[model samples]
Target: MSRRQRLMTLTRMLPSLLRILRRFRPYLRPQAPLLAGALLALLLSTAARLLEPWPLKLVIDRVVVATPSGGVSGIALIDALDPTTLLTLAAIALVGVIAVRGIASYFSTVGFALAGHRVLTEVRNDLYRHLQGLSLSFHDRAKTGELTLRIIGDIGMLKEVTVTAILPLLASSLVLVGMIAVMLWLNWQLALAALLPLPLLWLTTLHFGRRIQAVSREQRRREGAMAAKAAESMAAIRDIQALSLEKGFAESFCCEGNRDLREGVKAKRLAANLERTVDVLIGVASALVLWLGARLVLTGALTPGDLIVFLAYLKTAFRPVRELAKYTARLAKASAAGERVVDLLDEESDVQDRPDARPAPAFAGAVRFEQVTFAHTPGKPVLDRIDLALKPGERVAIVGPSGAGKSTLLSLLLRLHDPTEGRVLLDGVDIRTYRLASLRAQMSVVLSDSLLFAASIRDNIGYGAAGSDTGAEPGADEAAIIRAARLANAHDFIEALPNGYDTLVGERGVTLSSGQRQRIAIARAALRPSPILILDEPTTGLDRHNAQAVIQALEKLAQGRTVLMVTHDLDLAARADRILYLEAGRIREEGCHAELLAREGAYTALVRGRSGPPSPALSPAITRPIGADYAFGP
Candidate 1:
């Protein structure tokens, strides 16, 4: 690589590396004491390594040169001492230096390993918490498998690199600096020559490191994509088998795996080439230094022992350079992994609570929307200028076609997404002013596809306890659970199961029938003491017999709560105290079934288009004129 190109690459990488380190400050600060001890041990070890060669140099120069009468000795002190005694001291000093180096090296490795593992563990945990706090919009756009790899796989790579590459590089750099200082003290001219190969090593590292990092990043992304594909296929295994798509999915997954393999091989090849180039440069530097040192020895500018010591320091000094080349690829991969972790940590949640928000008080269940406008994408409003109100203990059923914003209206009320304009109010106060958890605790929901965790049936029901606001632990008592189950008409089937309430429902309750799962979900919602209830197509995907049972249970559950139900069943809509007919993101009609039908407006056309006339459950009220009777009032 050209010097300018190497400099530019280094310039780009240094800031990112520094940013990654800055992000780790909080995690690193806690382990400062361990790191400090490690630094001390490293210094002691470096000092020992620097002292190690001196004893041999002294023996070869002083004791070997001394005659029986200490003839021709340069130092008077050495001349006064016997050569035999001096040689013995030198051997003892060498053993002591080696012993200290070994002991210090052990402590330093343990300390750095302990610190690195602990820091990475903290990073992993904090990353998970941040992911959970992110808004649903983010999760909607993100893949589960990629996020999973960042939490587990990327952080693991960082830990491995820290242990295998980072600590050793740190120790070797210290040794390199110490060796250079000694070399300069011995002879400054030779010291300059020893360092000539370093600039070449730097350029080589810059060229290869960037390529390795890029490949590693691509490999990680491919791995995450493969994981996502596998997770997607497994989650839809039933459909995959029914459609016979297993072979197709396997082929796609293999394709991604092969791409990752190619990247891995390419990274290793670059690393190997860089290491071999570094070896050649070091050999050249050594040959030049040996020739110069031998000339100095012969010209009486240096002794034979001095020349030997210089060559020894030269090899030791360059060893760190060789080590850096060998580990450059690993370090680059780790750098890429660390950047991924840092990016995740830096992601700010879109819907976190405001700092000034307060816990919500007990709700009386009055809800209103004031000119609320929302769109998942701008300029395409889903619920446009919706101005509506619901009284305490009233039941409102929203009926609309697909994509008519029926679900979006309910989502706005629940604060799943903030309105682009205006506000959603609960009991006359803006709901955004309330803490998210507390506000959500004031209502209970049963979705169309009721999801059950892989746990005992009792535990799944107990998730509703958060809405109860009882300040008690999760998981209701047996009596309460049975009561809620009975209210939802789920107790009989649950009792029929071998494990009763303790039965493991399996993931998403896949083992249970649609009706059974719906009933359990209803039981969970019923267990909550919240005064506001939201139901979305509760009878969807169920047989008529099961739907009737569910409707009966729902009637009992909605006895005194303010209920908002979104459904397409006109039979059910006709029975509501109030009905809203939404279309094209606006409420086209709003009144009781009889009032809207009497007008022969949009609501009337909708009723006429159903498979048949409204059911007899509507009673005498269906014949009333628009103003003849009250739909709902206390």
Candidate 2:
């Protein structure tokens, strides 16, 4: 960060500052009175401090020295007053000046702190709200720890500028202007000498501030990365332990940790050097003022009283400059933080609904994907020219060897990611034409592993009802939650727990078994009463009995609702009103289980390969776990 780089950084941040002001404008107008009062307090404090040295000058030249009577010199007009009386008056005035300044300073600090707090609260709320609406793709590519740092650490740093940087700079600038005006009035020659070092101080700020800013920026970036690394490692700790890769993860974390430490140290070092340079400059200015003022006084060109007053104001004035100079690094860090926040807020979401989009109509459970093609990355297609339709109450199972886009097709119905080309519709209306929330509300999804909050099991189960306790309704009524749980075969196990449904589950429901979590998730989806339901590998990873229990629960959930299940289990596929066999992103075969098997094509071969022989037809009891044998096929 040289001077040029610092300038560039400031230029870049100018827009962001305007952005901040725009955000605060709504809050600021309402609190203008408080802000005005705060500024007034600062002004009054500076006025009192300026009044302070005048009393000392009067005491020295008029009270103690008792200038040649009459209307003597510039200040001695009290001819009849005793020296003791005059001195006492001057002393009292000094104390009163100090008291007023202290009181005003207190008010200034409190007002700014409260105002900053209120404004920052609004900012955080808006940022968080925007974050919640961003598309899934945005979150998929973003690191949790980095986003957390932006929300917490970055915003916190910007707050420092509000409370510490801006106010202090304003007060310091005010003090500088008033003090120098008085100094020039006292004696122009001495004031000139005192102010000469200002240019040098500015130069010093640029010289040192750049290095500090550069190092600080690096430090902030490194810390964010380190936080992200730590969070990622902790999140995957179970996998690391199971795979015996803890040592590898620990080493990687340490490497980033060390980089962050070095950058932090470098930034601190630069800040220290900047502080010392400013301190030295302040000393030089003070010494220069004293040397010239003393010379003027002894030559009868100025009074001793005048010289003392000038020196006092000069010294006090330089203190603000010193404080300002010391804060360059701090201001830079704050600016960096603001920049990061602005960048995140500026991110555009591709999945947001159109401006004309309205609430989705009640779904009839009719779905259509017309010429849908998608690619997570361009040139490597996942689905090509996909076309499918299902009527109300239709139960469709999508089966394919791995990499056949079964899950992708299900995701399209929910619009987690829209197709790169083509359209998906619900009941003849393009789904994207409807508000995202309403569209999602019409479909209930039960993933193989759906997350539960770290709240009571009752709250977790209740959340499944879109817009109910979790989505729209009132308190998570215990009766309603239990009903859904019973429907999903989760009530029995939930009651077996010490606290039943009231038990607080750990993060992601880690305290419960895979089967228990799945059933709770199923109960949540079942509670949604949505016209459409999707179950992805609903019994994946479950033991035989749990799988049997889950299958039964699914059978009930599938009734009435138009259900789409993605699975490899021949037994599950047999239960669908119709099953589609997908391969290479296209529908290769579709019909009842018997029809597909009798044709003895792609669908028949897949069943035979996994089940070890071709059967007369698909059985309704062959539940088996398939691994990468499922991600993609040869």
Candidate 3:
């Protein structure tokens, strides 16, 4: 893009950036008293700097120029001063001014930093909350490391702009303006000479600002890529080690890191060049001012004191121009960082609660699927034309081959993703008509890959029962937690841990075995005791021993609750009262174990492991006793 186009883009994005900053206005408000103090300090500091030159002018004009004699001895001149008294007063005034300036500057800096920190804290919190609310699809496609860098690294860049760049820019501008006004009052011609470098400085900044912004953006993008690579590699470190791909991954990371470093160095080089150019221009201007002021003094049109004062003001005025030129790079970096932060905040989730939706009333687990159909993508249905009902406390098992839509069926029941063509109803009410939180709260779900947070075992088990008094008193009751653990067959293992129930699980519970994590998840779900329960491959990744233990726990959990389990194990499916066979997104057949076998179709072939005529051993009567008393005996 052309330089002008780049600048235009930055200008266009400013309004949005400002709007984001406005969200932090409340944080800024509380610092008003500090801001006021800072402003006062800044004003005092500027006043003190302006006053320093006046004393020199006073000494030159009053003492030196007013000597009546053609020449006076140095001793006579010292005596003429009333010596100690005059010097003492001047020293006292100068010291007082310096003291005020120092104090003001200190307070101002503290105030600004506090405000910036407060704003950044809020921004980080909001970003994290928004990230949590985003749909799973977004996270599936997003890079973990890149998102982490944006939240930490990019946001840190913004803090530099707020605490350092912003205040310096403000204080310097004020000082520059004040100095220029004083110089103009002293001598307009000389002031014009001193001001000659400013236009060039401005031109230089305008020329390089867009370039710096481009380089900074490129650098940030590369950094994010590097972070993403590192994060991916770290997450799969075990796989990388097993495959011996560490060298390859390291080389890839180095390539990205080198790119970021190169872009960063390029920006720094350009900024340095710009600063050097400004310095040269200011030097030339200062020389010209001095030469002109000397000629004016020689012609008796100005005094030595006036020339000295003009030079002092000239230095002050050029200081901000020089500083601003240097800060252009920092400002560019901050703008890019702010843009990323704003992008995250601007994202709108696909799933949001309806405006007039009400919290769903407590349910008694009557779930119905009315011709529901869904697809992750167009023209590829995952669940199709399904109509089914669960009469309050029915125990149903879904059986199918891999990718047979069994898991999708259970997911739809929980409303993880809504049906595209039809509605799911609970107790005769459409699920979407109710608040999502309340709707989801009515069902308990357990997935094969159970995730655990870095918290005590007790906390993990009671995660779902937040804010409830399960046993007695508020908070998660220790007794109730233990009961739930015992029911899930997790009590024994948990008690064996170093801290028992209070033991902190490492990240994702990596310290525990897969079966242990699954049991804890089951215990969590059991604690919820929702009206409806859906288990998706809940017994997967477990050996025979653990599977049996889990199954026993599940039997207790399913007692009076409506249960729908999706599994591939025919043995587990046989335990359910009824089994539904799904094929190609539709329910092909559903019956008791013997009924499906009597048909001598898919289920029979699958069980016998052959395509020939069904064996007598696979006879329907043998597989299932039709008239036998099968209810659980007390």
Candidate 4:
């Protein structure tokens, strides 16, 4: 099996709590000192609890009953005092014990909470980084909402469980152990009677705990599915509204939401049942211990003060059991969330740099694909064995039918995915030998559908320079940005806007028209100082005026760069120095436009198919003059 497969199998094999602790141990290590302090405080609080009942016992034995002969050893001063002063001292001691326990408990809780927050914050950061590093294939198969839930919702839940449930359970267990030891030492018979309901408590806990966890896990799963649905619907709200699909999507989302609600109710019901069952068991144990202790006190075998202290310890001992039942459901839910996070972390990316990979040097932009082949699925090659090369400063266009692997060629050259066989070389070095970041820094791309962030136009354009190896601070060179925007014919409209370059664009650039968005994207790409320029259907949807402006921008952007254009616009392809006609993953024809048309093959048919009723203004004969301020010029 592969490493990812083995990890997945192991994730399923291990218990949830154990898996989470073991897998996330690295995050826990840094918080060790804080966690240790929290644990120490908890122990001190447990010790305070053990001493809590003694002051009451002292009042009963020494002051109320007037037992004169017996006094606590090593405290003769207290025994030397009169009954009224002794009563006052006992009362003060009771408050002091309660106060000490309260103070320790507060510190312990705060410490645990601080540690949990720090550790979970690191976990969330690592989870997000891992998700970003994962290959496109993993993302193509994953849900955005579910991944978002793991980062925000799941990690937040883990924090809550760690502080509120896990720490308290650990402290309660210590109290249970300490109280039980004292009860046994005080009176063995009464202690044994106090332990009778424990076996039944154990069985009840086991039964109800499993059911609650199962219900909680299912509820969490449904919640994730619901979130995924909501996110998907929101992301495509425009398309859904245009197509009138809102009702159907809403109904589907509500169905998942309702199912999640039902599971949540079921989990709560199970937890409630468990708590009540535990209460009954605790009541029976308390009654048995009280009955036996009272008889012992009356028969002179046990003192009245001793019986009172014994009962107090007995009550405290069962507190852990009651708490265990109370927090069992929350722990189970967090465990389910932890499993989800671990499963995501286990997914190994199909694409990553080799250990010996080095940063890519600056490129002259000569590219070659030698016997290259690739497939998203085995035996279904998207690009077959094909040899191709481009000289430095050459402009090459690729045209083919849908699914002809034209775009796949661009993807391979960009190193988005490695070839299934053979190699792709840039300036005679295999692209795989270069670091991904540095290799990608040598190229700039403009796509058909431009996407923009919800930021100012200046910031969006600044991203291009950020990706380059310019070594300049991002957005620091506003003069260069304005120059690029001018080259793309985008400066006039941008300045006409209410806020000019600093105007905020809506998500995905929905606030702007298509031509304006495209011009801005061109400006962004033009800002990059890369030797290779990639244009994929850059003018596909533009109107005549915008298309003419974009073509003029492209003419400037193409100067002195190795330009690779993928388009169905025969008019654009005809302008390239050479054209490669691809069909079914293989290069069918390659030559200058006139030479390809002379061959009377796929290239001729493609051109004829698109050129039947073309406008004269968009004709192949029309050409644009290049500007002095070149996009890729040094």
Candidate 5:
């Protein structure tokens, strides 16, 4: 990115970061009194540190210096006082300063820690919410591990910068300014000599800062890639183990991890060199100040006391410069992290609600695809010029070979993706004209591979139903759920489990058989009772017995709902009100099961395992009856 662009991005993020911090206002506001007390202590400590050199000067110029008159009995001598008394007073002041500084440091550390955590919490929450609002295409392209790192690791890095670095740097800068002002007043020439190296120091810091930022950005990117690799490996562990690809995955993970480590080491090395350089510069500046002050004293242009004070301020002045060098790399690292977070937040969702869109009224589920065409990539259409229509309460089956756009057609209906051309309509209104949420709310979908979260069986069953009743409604009234489960042939096995309805399913329902999971998904979809239903190979994983049971449940579910089934099962397609035979990206042929069989086209060859056109006199069993509402003209 260009410097100006980076600056503008940072400027935009400042408001959001500030807003995140404000979430901790309640915690911070309550600690205001303590913070004020801490500030008072800090000021007192700074005053004490500044005053320490003045007293050393007083002792040197008065008590240690011989007076022209035989004895030193002036105000400076009085201020120096008896050795025992002076030691006692100095000790007391040192203790007081240390006590105040310690208290202030504690309060500041604790307060900022609370604020940082609260801000991180807000960041995570906002990121997660934004992720939810983002379109499916975004998720399809994003790595789970990388996104997780942004939500967890990146936010954690920001928390550290906020609590440990930002406030301390601010306080240190204040101390530096105070010391510089005092040093300049004492001896302008000596102060200038001490400050001479500052310009070089700043230049070096800027160079190192840029390098650190670049390295840190690379490190974070590699870290995210490593995380993505690890997550992908873990998610597909079964496949890896079955294929004996463990070593391959491990090598891949190691490669990413090593890249991150190399970048991190490079960043650390640069930071270390920057700090060492600052230290050497400060040492040289200190030596120069001392040498200059001694010359002024020898020339009677400066007092021994003044020289001591100048030396002390010189040390104090370099302290912040050294700190600035120390934290320059840290700031750079944080800037890179901030840039990434801002990038995610700035990303625009590809599918967004139209400003004039309205919620779809209750749908009777009449669906239409008017020459819909779509593709994940340009000029590579997955569904092309597909025109079809389903009247209210009609059941249609889409049958085709794999990669023939059967599933793609179903995705269009659900608006998982919008058609690149034409439109999908519901109840005669363009689907795009209706709010996405309202349009989706009218339909229920069950996929071949159903994912169940790690939750109670009851929760999973009631996943689609609103206002769940585990108590008010008798266990029997859960009969509806049980009945749905029974129809899916899942109730018998479920009842045999220890907790039955209350059993907690493991993550992704791994504890359940594939057939069981599919049945549960069907039960969930059935519970929705929407006017529209989508079953994408819903019985693919089931055994003959289980598949039969599921088909029976589905038959009831499809009764009054507009049903769209994407499947390769010819028998199931034969029972549909109408069958759409898809080839490549278009509907090559469509008709009632008997009529399509008579035509002896792709459907006939697919069903009879023939290489040519089908015979008209195919057996009645071979040409099953299409449902009552079936219609197919093209």
Candidate 6:
């Protein structure tokens, strides 16, 4: 069992280590000089340590037991020196060697640590940038906590291997070779006895290496699961409390937390068990060498001092061997972490701009969808064979049942996902030909569940204003933000707050009411210099007063820009120049509101539901042709 496993140590650590090498290759190449310098320092430190043990051997033989006639000569000068004087010189030399070793080790570790930090930071930054650039579809399926673990926990473990384990492993390997060579020259029989337990030690390390790695990987995964559960519970704490679901959520969280704890305990037990076993094997090897060396000393094949040096060298030689086992264990786990980080970095994003895509010229707001079809999954169409054209500045309202693909229109318009078939064009050119940033710059959107960052109201508004300016950073256009807020009727409330626009809106705008958050979002959209506007249930959160005010403002804002609104309110839909009734993923009917109502189709049914008796309003007298400034009374 031991022999077969003896050579498996490298096999266990190799896979994860290889991944680390490949992922960090670009970052490491530029730091080769620093790495090389660290290696040199490690070598110097090892030399000093090896010399340290020899000084004692010299004192024991040439000075402490030097019978005036001299047992044997160490150096020409030391042979002539008196015992007391030689002992003093040897002690001083030992101190100097120790000092040199300390300095070298310090410099080597510091260099490696700095380099490791640099690489870790770069990896973190690159991972974050890539994650941000990934398509929404990817984020929809990937867990937030898993990605966070890769960024925070996994990379942190990798740094320990890179900075702490690497240099010691290199230096210890060299020292191991040099010490064994010296020990053999001193007494080949003692050297052989010293290495007798090496195979067993190697087998022990190999046996436990995989167990530790497997346990640690399981531990990290459980931790991620726990983190995700906690985040989810915290995010919905309000609902949980309101619905009296705290107990159930707490129980669920505890279940996951216990799972993570068990994983951690398993890993600790494996590591502790390996450590104890290695220590016992090491003791056995030392005992064997001691017994043999004593017999050889008594046989006059080796002197007492020679025996002492042999023992010292034996301990020194095996020191690295013992430490090597520990390092291999750590490296195994670090490799698992590296694998996770590499997996995330290597993940391909589904959305990417083509090399030949050019910056879109300013849009004229003329939008068209020609035979467009899209599906999140094959054969499960979200939009199918849609054909429509909206003249520049047309006000179009889209009404549909819950899954009739109303929201999907906004996604396609923003190029969040390309069509499964056909084309969407702006001004007769395919939108895919435009650079993403340029194309998005020409559109503004307001969704009911729009996200807000933990920032001041002014910064949130400026974030949108900045989008209108191609070269400016977000939150750089304060004046434009204020202007947009006034237009959205948000400026009065903003000023009424204690800190005005500078007040920090807590996480996800939780500090404000839903109505206030909605207004702020509307202001954000109003700040964009876009030729097209897309709103989904835009007035859902507003009170009647705010809704009416915003609707009035939107009516004015709608002029000279194509507006597409998705709403359940048929009254709002009736105000559009045209109403598009969508069902199942295809347009069923589209015409001026009065015209569609008169046809008694899907639009008529929706209007009838909201208007309750139809009130003779579907008659031709009410079928006036839609014109600019057209609106249905609130």
> Candidate 1 at residue 7, lDDT?
81
Candidate 5: residue 535 lDDT (0-100): 86
lDDT of 3 by residue, 470-507 (tens): 33222257777888899899999999999999899987
Off by over 4 Å in 6: 1-13, 67-75, 160-171, 303-306, 324-332, 610-634
Q: What number of clashing residue pairs does each candidate have, in the order they appear?
A: 0, 8, 0, 0, 1, 0
Candidate 3 Cα errors over 4 Å, as ranges: 1-23, 26-37, 64-87, 300-302, 376-381, 401-415, 467-475, 599-634
Least lDDT summed over 10 consecutive residues: which range in candidate 4? 625-634
Candidate 4, residues 1-634, lDDT tens digits: the string is 3446545544553566687789889988888999899888899899999999988887887877755433542487977887789889888988898999999999999999998899889889999999988877788888999889989999999999988888888888899889889888988888889998998897777777777878888988888888788889888999999999989998898888888888988888989999999999899888987888889877877777888988788777888789889997898899899999999888888878889999998899999999999999999999999899999999999988878898878888888888999999999999999888888888989988879889999988888888778855556699999999998899999999999999999998999988888888889989988899988888777776777778778888778999988887667777788899989999999998889988998787766555244423334432542112112222
By summed lDDT, the worst window of 10 consecutive residues in model 5 runs over 467-476
Candidate 3 clash total? 0
Identify the superior model by lDDT, candidate 4 or candidate 5.
Answer: 4
Candidate 4: how many backbone clashes?
A: 0
TM-score of 2: 0.91
lDDT of 2 by residue, 487-554 (tens): 99999999999998889999988999988998898888878868999988777777766777777787
Across residues 523-593, which tens digit of lDDT does each residue of candidate 1 receive? Answer: 98888888899989887877667877777778878888999999776667767889999998899889988
Q: Which candidate would rank higher by lDDT, 2 or 4?
A: 4
Model 2's number of clashes is 8
Cα lDDT of all candidates, in order?
Answer: 0.84, 0.79, 0.77, 0.84, 0.75, 0.78
Superposed by TM-score, candidate 6 places the C-alpha of residue 617 at a distance from the truth, in angstroms, of 18
Task: List the candidates' TM-scores in order.
Answer: 0.90, 0.91, 0.86, 0.92, 0.83, 0.91
The C-alpha RMSD in Å for every predicted model, in order, reads: 4.3, 4.3, 5.2, 4.8, 5.9, 3.9
Q: Which 10 consecutive residues of model 1 have the lowest summed lDDT?
A: 625-634
Superposed model 2: Cα runs more than 4 Å off: 1-27, 65-81, 466-475, 610-634
* Candidate 1 local Cα displacement, residue 595, angstroms: 3.0
Q: What C-alpha lDDT, on a 0 to 100 scale, does residue 109 get in candidate 6?
A: 87
